[model samples]
Target: MTCRVVQWATGNIGTHALRAVVRHPDLALAGVYVYAEDKAGQDAGALCGLSPTGVTTTRDVDEIVALGADCVLYMPRLCDLDVVCRLLSSGANVVTTCGEFHHPASMAAEVRDRVVAACAEGGTSVHSTGSSPGFISEALPLVLSSTQRRLDTLTVDEFADLSYRDSPELLFDLMGFGRSSTDLAGRVAHAQAGFGPSLRLVADALGVPLDALRSHGEFATARDTTEIAAGTLRSGTVAAQRITVEGVRADRVLLRFRATWYCTTDLTPAWDVRDTGWQVTVEGDAPLDIAIRFPVPLDTIASVTPGYTANRAVNAVPVVCAAPPGIRTTVDLPQIVAALG
Candidate 1:
């Protein structure tokens, strides 16, 4: 049976998800949810740079919900809890990359309970996935560890050049890009929200329960003002920031994920940004290190295979929709295979 899908937004990742939804053989694009007034009246196909699909975009939440889509590719600018809750209660399974409880297991008890209640009330499901806090940290590491009989430490790092990202507000304000290094709480909070679940996924996979989990954040300051695509980096302001989630077992770091993002020509105590987009190291049995690089071809809207994230969430829709209601994680689903040929 073909699963009906609604594209929730047309943002960086959403744009890719929209295209994938239209192409997936097992999925049908029933509706397109637009948040921006300018995008509301356009055709869904036009928004994704495709031929007319007869799926006109609309900002009306009621309209999309009324479409009775079986699954929602719920990517908005950010997580909108009210919207998510309402959708779950409306009997629609949700799969999002919006950094909203990607791992429902990591959410607070109260919030988790509410999601559970919504799922029970509607008999639906919700899942969250992404590229960084997602497969790299959770899925890939566990897959690599299958060969290792003994495992000690696992580290996943992502050094991204956000210059390719177009969201100025996201790159600057939300990320504290030009903010004072003295105050990095905002940036740290942003990373923790996403990384927490991925860390949990790793610990669960290894059958190791962490005694304590901690968030670590640090930043480097710019010696001189510099300009980048996202925004400007002023002297003395933050030029680079690192966010880490460490899962501890008996005082040793068993698993950890770190994301370092910067946008300057001069980095203090300089370190070269690894040209590889991602790196995963396993200091166990045979000691392994792996790096990944995606050839993000130059385009008007620069992105690093945003399709990777789109496919991550889209491929999980079937499993999430089939699962019992509540917060589902990577642990709840099997290996996701792409339906796009």
Candidate 2:
């Protein structure tokens, strides 16, 4: 059963997904959706550095809907509800990297209702997944918890060394690196909204429904001027930041996720930091400490990081497409078995 797939958004992650789809034995490149006019009319293969696949890319949503693909790999940087609803309502099962749809119950009532209605109308399903909130925060914890009958606290620590990432706009302008500490209310809220859903989903899966979700952020300033791939980090500027999201139940935190992102190691207040990877520590009857590291060198992280996100999404297509019509979470679907042939 070859599943027809549409590759949406040819960005970093999407590009990797496109290449994977073209190579997968059980998947066919039915269509390609691009956001830039320059990418339009180009062969999908060319966009992802493969031979011509005969499927041309398009900037039109209507064209994509008309293709009636079995599944759409939606990897846009930012998600659009309208586009998602339209794709769902058009009968295309969606597998996305968007963090919001990871846990449907965590979504706002109106947004959830709209998506539910769309799924009902088209008789399709949508799933949200990615490397961080999806694989690390949700999937890995669920797997580790199976070893314990009496579980206490589960913490997932994510560390990313962005010193070699060359995206200036992303590091400096967007993430607020190399800047003085200002009001972090917005950043805190963003972290809560981004990671809270995954935490809630994990809690619910563990039968420990959270009473509330709490989030906070902390930052360390640089001790001296440093040069990074993104830009310059001046002395006494924000160099490292950590955001923690907790799932609280019965006045205790049952699940916790902390993301520590840093551009430089030299900071006024030294903090424990690691390479780009994740550490999962479980405290229970069968306590475990596990570390998953990206062994790639810092210079090539940009080239290799997308696969961590895109490949999981691509592997999930078959399961998501076969799922019952609704929003499917990591808990709802069976283990994703990649058809690597």
Candidate 3:
């Protein structure tokens, strides 16, 4: 059976997800969902630079869901609880890109309960997935735990270049720091804060309460001047930031996660890390160190490859959409890993 999908946002993430649906044999583009004001009347294909797939974009979730779309992939710009609730309660399965859904701590009590209840009431399933929040944050740890031993600890580190990323807002506005750094104190706040929730995700996946988890973070800026071929800006800019999250039970750290995003120049061997490489250390009598690097072509937005980030979310849709409705986490769904052909 083909799954009809409604894309909620048309931004980089949404567009990529849409493209994935268009290419997938198991999924079909039913309709596109945009914010009330942003590109409401445009064809979904035009906005994403794809050929018309007979899917028109609209701002109406109720009407769209009623159109026989089996699932809605939400990519709201902000954590809009109302729209998410509507999708869940309408008996349409949902997958979102909002950071809040990826990390429940980002949601308030009322909104969280509302989403959970909506899913239950509508017999619909709701889930969120992305690069960090989805696979690396949740799936990787879950994969490691398969070894089956007296669990000691797990650590996941991410090294990325902000300039290389399609969205600069994640590093600038959200992190709350300029591109350059002048103050020696390293005082600028982070914009694309990733580590905190990443650690928490690992904890949640491991079924450990955060009561004993300890979080610590440190930010750093480029000491020397740096500039990317794509953008303007000289020295004294915020270069990079590092954050670590350690989950502990009974004063012993059980999980440790470190995430670092940097400018291209500040990134040593930037090309290598950008592709995908991780160090997994297991502590036991013998101890073990494992490195996993997923390789694909380096070009961004490849026509044939779709988008890796989008695939991470889209590949999970089957399990999420088919599951019993409710606000579910990665643990709630079948293991969805990004595979290469």
Candidate 4:
């Protein structure tokens, strides 16, 4: 039973989803969704640097949805309520890479409500997952809890160098940095402000209320600004962000997340606890530290394949997609560990 798939967006994540669909025996390429007018009517394969899959990109989302795809994998730019409602009502299940699902109740309140109602009326399903808040934020901690006797704290750090990325917005747009120190200060003041959903997941996982959460910022820049290889990015500047969420009742830090981005390639990439790699630590009666490095593949296209990140997204899909039609959080869904086929 090949799952017919219509992938939205053509960015890094979207490219990975498209490739996975092409390679997966259980998935079928149905169509590609592009919001940009210039990219409309283009070949999905050519746009993503793959051989043609015969699925042309389309701006007519309704037409694509009506084509009878079993599922729509949305990896494109964020769409509004009208579009979301239409997609849900189309009777196809949905999985997105957008952060909208991080906290369906917080940032996307109206969209969530509309989706829930639409899914009910249309008898469909929808779920959203991503690398940062989705996998690192939700899945990793859950994985750590199964083996440990007592769980004290869970920390996740993402160390990525966006210097190879071709977008200037990659700095501010994705990483949430600023052009200057003052601008960055303002940004940091509200950095953790949008993290309600991620924190909610942690709280739900631990069965506790979110008591206190604080975030601080540090900035680093390269010696020079305009000569980086991917593009002429300002040198001597980077954003190092740390976010902490504490449980008041537990009197301990439940979830700690930190991400640092370097504008250039000269500096070393490392994390505080594990140093230069990814690690999950569970400290209790039986202490445990699980360390794994998500190797950044050399090829640009191959790098976006979502390796560990996909496992996180794919693992969560069954829970959310098969879940009763409604807007849900990590806590709202049944707690289950991921298993490989």
In model 2, the clashing pairs are none
Question: What TM-score against the true fold does each predicted structure earn?
Answer: 0.88, 0.96, 0.79, 0.77
Question: Can you tell me which runs of candidate 2 are displaced by over 4 Å?
Answer: none
lDDT of 1 by residue, 1-341 (tens): 78999999888889988988888898899999887899988889998888999999999999988998899989877778888989999999999886666566567788888888988988998877877667787779878888788889988888766655567888777777787754667656766777776777778777887777888788887879877767677888877778888888889998888887777647776755664378889998889988887656423325546777888888888888888888777777778777665
**What TM-score does prediction 3 earn?**
0.79
lDDT at residue 226 of model 3 (Cα atoms): 56
User: lDDT by residue for model 2 over 1-341, one digit each (tens)?
Assistant: 89999999999999999999999999999999999999999999899999999999999889999999999999898899999999999999999998879898888999999999999999999999988879988888999999999888999998999999899898888888888974567878987888899989988888889999998989999999999998889999989999898989999988999989999888779998988899999999999999999999999888999999999999999999999999999999999988976
How many angstroms is residue 98 displaced in model 1 relative to the true structure, after the best TM-score fit?
Answer: 2.8
User: Per-residue lDDT of 140-228 in model 3, one digit per residue for the tens?
Assistant: 77776777566777666666545544444655555633554332222212212344455566666667755554455454554455554
Error of 3 at 112 (Å): 2.8
User: Which run of 10 residues does model 1 get worst, by summed lDDT?
Assistant: 295-304
Model 4's number of clashes is 8
State each model's CA lDDT, in order. Answer: 0.80, 0.92, 0.66, 0.61
Per-residue alpha-carbon lDDT of candidate 4 for residues 150-175, written as tens digits (9 for 90 to 100)? 66676666555554555656555656
